[model samples]
Target: MTAGSHDETLAVLTTACAAVGLDPSGAKPIRLAENALWRLPGGIVARITRAGQHQPTERELRLARWLSAQGLPVVRPLPGIEAPATAAGRPVTFWEELPPHTNGTIPDLATLIRQLHSLPRPDFPVGRLDPFVRIRDRIDAAVTLSDTDRDWLRDRLADIQSAWASLPEGLPECLVHGDAWTGNVACPLAGGPALLMDLERCSVGRPEWDLVSTAVKLTTTGTISKTEYERFCTIYGHDVLNWPGYDTMRAARELRMTTYAAQHAATNPAWRPEAQHRLACLQGHNGPRPWKWMGIV
Candidate 1:
């Protein structure tokens, strides 16, 4: 699909609002990444996906509904709508808009992660947390690669996968928030509690996979302070860096981060340097403190 412009989001929002019987004029953009999100009138949010991505969109809605049924604090789907309504070649789903709040912090993230890790496994089967699969898919989807970069990435993925497979499983497995980084978490209305926001990656997997993103960010990028990192480790009750498989886990996380940037680098020139920087850092070309990363959006 073409890189989505605001027009795509507007079209989806219009269709979604009409399906649910609301005005489309008030829909406002929330974010754009794997999916586009917009806040509509009357406390509803519409998530718009690429055209023909029916199955994955259905899975996301199912996961969100299941999480809500389990009494986990998540953004709920709009009432009285059979979702994934088609709109201008995209699948649009609506969610209950979260009340006014800021993005969550590490502690908030830790709380949500702990809650998800403790919950009983879902009755339905969900995907496993496979970093290699995601990394490989990202590399394949990325259109910005030089032939040399592509070969190097595949070689790196192979090495990481071998390491990932060989390492001992260090954490008890359970349902995990696939991408548990701070940005995906949100502080609740009136400071009730922090809640998980993005359900796209919700699946059964090792808890370590959820923790790896934050740990690696603290290690490779100086974005968050060491104190904050220690606070996360303290709250989560496991310093993932000390775990035996941490190198493999961190490598996998770094690759995912790099390739996510590379996937957008083709059309977003700003992401090219950031992607290359992450790739170089993973290759041990960067040293010590402060490997800055640029955000794509």
Candidate 2:
């Protein structure tokens, strides 16, 4: 997160805690991005998200409660409390703080994902994945990008949107952890196995879409070792690359990742080079794999 936004988060945290009669003093900041995360001394984690993100925040709370009822090991919002209150006009939520543990591994993630996919769909409203929603914002946020770059990005987004519309179903559409990836899973929980977090994009979609994140990390970036990649497939019981519609989905995923980095470059200049490299690679001027993607604090 940028330095300028830190104060705003602290101020919002204070106000929100005061409204609930919870102490905000000595709260520790965890992450600051689309949401501002703070860990309160009372062992609860507070999430302050953008005001426009209210609906998703509400959906997330519903999912959390649902997961808990299913005996899932995922995190849960605070019980017996009204949530998603406006803190400085931003939506804020409280979660039960989990005990410290090692970061979840790819195998751990695959196991959790398998369990998640097995469940019948919840009664709550959930639509299919929408990869195009962030395109406009990401494009507009690239304030310093060249006109040519901007044009190319817009064209790519348009092409992907069209392609996504007709994507053949390889795996049966299931309730996926929409943003499933190693980053979204936490290690063995206190009473359960691997834990999945980040339910913002939880929706019914191609099961393969969730696996694309790992596939990209392995094939496109080569950040993950081949042995590990194979293990992921073995555990998950399918190699996504061999799926007929894999390339199409992978391409769309790459474009979204590229656009995400590009959008952040406007506020964090360090993201520009990586963003440019990603765009160039997509255009076939392939840079070496295992890109050093960093700098979005």
Candidate 3:
């Protein structure tokens, strides 16, 4: 029942769809990262998470309902379906498919983030953020990494963990979207309001944890223009770069991105070059900041 291979994933999808009384005949894979997503017929998106993820998957559904109740635009779970169904030992949830949409603009993302941060914490236990979640596993499971490189990454992870523990006083803790990249926020092509997608990592943590993603893109990868970054800062109110703990957070984020690529590279060899480049930059083998790192799918 392990849903690693495409065939296994399809089997899980089929079982889950049957449980919900939906046909899986034309389910097409939309993405395969943290979760295996499939675009089901009739404008539904089915998500299958790794085995033993039922709790978080349930939490995601609850949070989505809560956010929508609070008048915040978010991707909604499919109506009339009891989600987080146990399917082939994996957790499966169905969502209402979003219309054609583009990646949210920097300002759109900043506004949504600010709005999200302004809300009071949820009534249910949303759990505290664990920035290091799955990090060590990624390091250990990355088959493409050499033992020397693995040791270096392990040491770097430890250093960052210590740094995180003693971060300088900054903004108050609140519900932070653990991953706030532009892609996670969808801007409807039909000119409707932007919607926040991907709720699994929604948890309470330092607001800076959310902001660091954009800051890294600006300073480390040079993906966003300075103008866009400035607008993001102005909209979000209070620049993350000015915070004393910015460097530590940035380093932690970069390390996570590196390990993520490395983990994926282990599965898809095509990703090895980008993964190695990212690791080299962190190891100081590639020259200083702004290494022109490309985004991996």
| C-alpha local distance difference test of each model | 0.80, 0.82, 0.91
Clash totals for all candidate models: 0, 2, 0
Model 3: residues >4 Å from true position, as ranges? 1-4
lDDT of 2 at 121: 91
Instruction: State the number of backbone clashes in model 2.
Output: 2
Cα lDDT of candidate 1 equals 0.80
Q: How far is 223's C-alpha from truth in model 3 (Å)?
A: 1.1
TM-score of each: 0.89, 0.93, 0.96
Q: Report the lDDT of model 3 for residue 32.
A: 70
Model 2 lDDT-worst window of ten? 288-297
- lDDT head-to-head 2 vs 3, winner: 3
- Window of ten residues with lowest summed lDDT in model 1: 1-10
- Give candidate 3's TM-score: 0.96
